[model samples]
Target: MFEGHDPYLVALSVVIAILGGYTGFGLAARIRGTPGVSHRVLLAGAAGFLAVGIWTMHFIGMLAAPIPADTVYLVLPTIISFLICALVVGISLFFVSIGEPSLRRVISSAILLGVGIASMHYVGMHGLSGNFTMEHDDSMVLLSVLVAIVAAYGGLRAFLARQDGIRLIASSIAFGVAVSGMHYTAMFGGHFVPLSGEGHHHGVSGLAASQQILSIVVAVLCFVIAAGFLLSLVPEPRRRGARDSAGETGALAPETDAAAVDVVSPQRDHAGPAAPRIVSAPLGGLGQPQRPAPVARLPLEGADGTHFIDTANVRSVRADAHYTRVHDGTRERMCPWSISEAEAQLDPSLFVRVHRSHIVAIPHVSFVRKEGDGAVIELDGPSPHRVPVSRAKIAELKARLGLARPHA
Candidate 1:
């Protein structure tokens, strides 16, 4: 029985897993920041990297084993294994990306991914056709399955984790180790028996039992992962904020990314805050069908149909994660524009930004009074609404309303 495994290949397998995890997770983190086509593309790319990492790790681990020459890999089974992994991974990521990832959803996604990965490994193992028969200890198989599930849990959590730089690196390393550990654990339980009669003929039309070909494939994939890793390390492009009707050039907001997890965009001090969260599957806010530019009427989706509200009727716009809530002198309705986008598109003179999360209209203001360190404006809509104003913007607000103190 062949017992010894190549140390270098084993190490390489782990390294590849880490690289792949980092690249995949990195791409996934940006899924919540971008909109529409870019979002879908990132999702596919992330899933592809993750599945390839898992499949490649399994294959490399197999090569590390001291299996006899002439062992052929069945084409169909090998392909099937990868497809299974990719399908499950994609589904899991998709689930968490849409809406807020509840605890139940996270656990369910983790379990599905874990079971799928284990299935992929065993199926690929079954693809080996040679002069030896393989048997696995039932206990060891269970242990490996458990390990796979646990590792998959970590991976899913990592996807949901705040995708900061250091944390991402840490999660990727932990993920890689756990994944490789499962592969080796199962291998430790496998026993091979030499067969004297004619060997398995299923691989006759499959892979040409050549280690060189396997090596080439692994090398090429590793290069691709490395390239993707480098690209992910680069800074994302800055986004230009929309120009207002007043023709005043708005300050550019930092770029946001869409993601598979409950995502939150970073705060921008200069521009109205960027709260570009990916709230729904395939995204509805920024991903909605294209419509005419919002010059006079701002479209709001209601339960029955799309309602376009007159911008002049807009009393105040409050930030709600990626979307905004508008008080239109009657009722508050959900608007898909981000806070920064609302600031940029709406008339700046009529609608002034008083706080990072609150925008107010001068015409609708019933009263302005001090509130603690900052100030609050009482809006005279049908159902009156009060909006908080930042202390920094109080002077500007006073000037806009002809209430500024005369120069000293």
Candidate 2:
């Protein structure tokens, strides 16, 4: 029984509502940067559904259809509808910021949702052109609310599905298709019309309904296809260099059992080279192998019982420690020490720690020899092992051996 309404205004209102919802939802998704397309697609679908729902509700209410003057109505329904729609839009944004969500997200979403509801109510109120009353019919309103809730659930599920077995792109496409279907189906049942003015009021009917239905189906199909396209662009997870979850490469995966681990200081390879190698231990009596030499202890004692240590406590073995030991026609090199100790006896000019275990005798050293790996100690001593300084005695070795300090 409606008449004299502008069809253009009615259509424009719906378009604006949809745009607002779409913009709000998509903005949230972009901000979230969630790992998959499902979240983005869900947000897009939610925006569309919310826009259509709000637009239909407001437009129908604004139609001012004939009602009994005595019919009682409460403002609560409008409030509830707006609140629900706003909440749907707000949560859509929440799903986007999935990584370590900040407290600000909650606050901002609440504020945005509140504003949306208020704006919807005002827009609906202003669209009314004549005196009319809303009826108190719980069934229809409840049905609408339930449908919106279902739509929301579907949207949430679609977003969450990305975390499950579903492929990211597939989840997004599925969500989009579902949202499009739900939106169009809900819109089809809405009793909507134009705002009354110079033109007679009418909405989708006959060919218009057919066209709208076709458009909705196409839109939904497009949404699903677009979601698939977007998902294809997501990057695949990379394999970590040393980690293996399934032992796929035939190597044993490291156990994830340790809750706490130690951080050992980096060892200085001054006594020897940094390269890892295999060395056999000296054979003991009765052809038994001697235990491998223990790493030279730090804070070593010099023959003269002098203490010489690096200020930083970086331990190094002397060069003499690397000399070969021969026994029973078998010759074996001593366990290597770090560079600082190696330099103590090897480079006479550079190495001057002169004493027992103090290879660098500064006074005895006349010149220094530098090598790429480390410097070699130069001394007049016929015994090489006797000249290598220990980690603790380099300074004493230098002082006794009459060595000059190397240039910085």
Candidate 3:
């Protein structure tokens, strides 16, 4: 079984395994919390990378084996095997992406993915034809499938769990080993038998080994590029940073609402940064509204570092779980503070709480629209930022924006 094992080709297969594992991890990152067409497109790209990478590795290993001169592979069966691997992987990724993270779901996805991998291996083996016939040890075959299942499960857990870079790298290495191990183990369990043939018979015509490898490499590259492009389309969450005055650890400070004061018209000088626009003042003492104060700066924090965001550039702030995401036109950053906390610090005249989890800056708000039982506030920015308004806040939000309440 190991007679024709080429060291260089085996090394190449290992490299492919590593690349596939890393790419799969990246895909998992992009898939989380993503919806609509983007998710589907990214899933497809991931599936292609994983499936093709595995399938190509397997075939390369086979090619490394020193086989009888008369042995040849059928083109049609090989293609079918590739397709089966890709389809199975694609479905597995879809299932994992859509399903909640539970023991049952994880196990089910792992089993499906393992079965696909095993099936692809055997089907590819069936493509081999010539004066020699191949047979596999049933126990070894079962063992290989089991290994695949366990590996797949581990990989899925690592991906679905917290996305730490170090953890992901470790899991990718383990997964690569599992993939390579299964192939070699299955090969170890197989033995070839001589056929009762006399003269050498020509087998089905197919591409040379070099051509096949080149094609597979090209296909994998295309899939990887497509996946990267799709991921790039999804905006990354931004981080806001503020330095502590005492030279302590930097943290995001809750925004303080600006007090009502005399309003000054905003001036936009193309040569410098844009000036903060004056927001409408809230109704004040004796029915005489005070002037709105200008918002100057915002403190933000991110995974990379801290940023003191300019208030003039802020488009909106969205609540995600316990943290708030601040969108500053181009990108968004995660703030350690909650929506309510952040709202309290922001200038009330400029930023209004539309929902328990959402706050929109008045200058960035484009329009408000009634949808279903609630309302949606749209922001003017590079991307559409729609903030949902709770029914209770609908009237207040409309009044603040000076828009007439939509009829029920």
Question: If scored against the real structure, what TM-score would every candidate get?
Answer: 0.61, 0.27, 0.57
- Give the best candidate by TM-score: 1
Q: Tens-digit lDDT track for model 2 on 57-161?
A: 353333333322222223344345455555656564553345433335544444454345334544333222223322323453344434444434444433322
lDDT for each of the candidates? Answer: 0.75, 0.35, 0.67
Which should have the higher lDDT, number 2 or number 3?
Answer: 3
Candidate 1 at residue 42, lDDT? 88
Residue 32 miss distance in model 2 (angstroms): 8.1
Worst 10 residues of 2 by lDDT: 324-333
Per-residue error (Å), model 1, residue 193: 1.5
lDDT score, candidate 3, position 332: 58
Compose the digit string of candidate 3's lDDT tens values, residues 138-225: 9999998998888778777766654445767788788878988888888888998876666745455664233355446545654664
Off by over 4 Å in 1: 1-3, 197-209, 239-408
Q: Which ten residues in a row have the lowest lDDT in candidate 3?
A: 242-251
Clash count, one per candidate: 10, 41, 15
lDDT of 1 by residue, 87-133 (tens): 99999888877655778998999889989999999998888887777
Evaluated at residue 118, the lDDT of candidate 3 is 83
Q: Rank the candidates by TM-score, best first.
A: 1, 3, 2
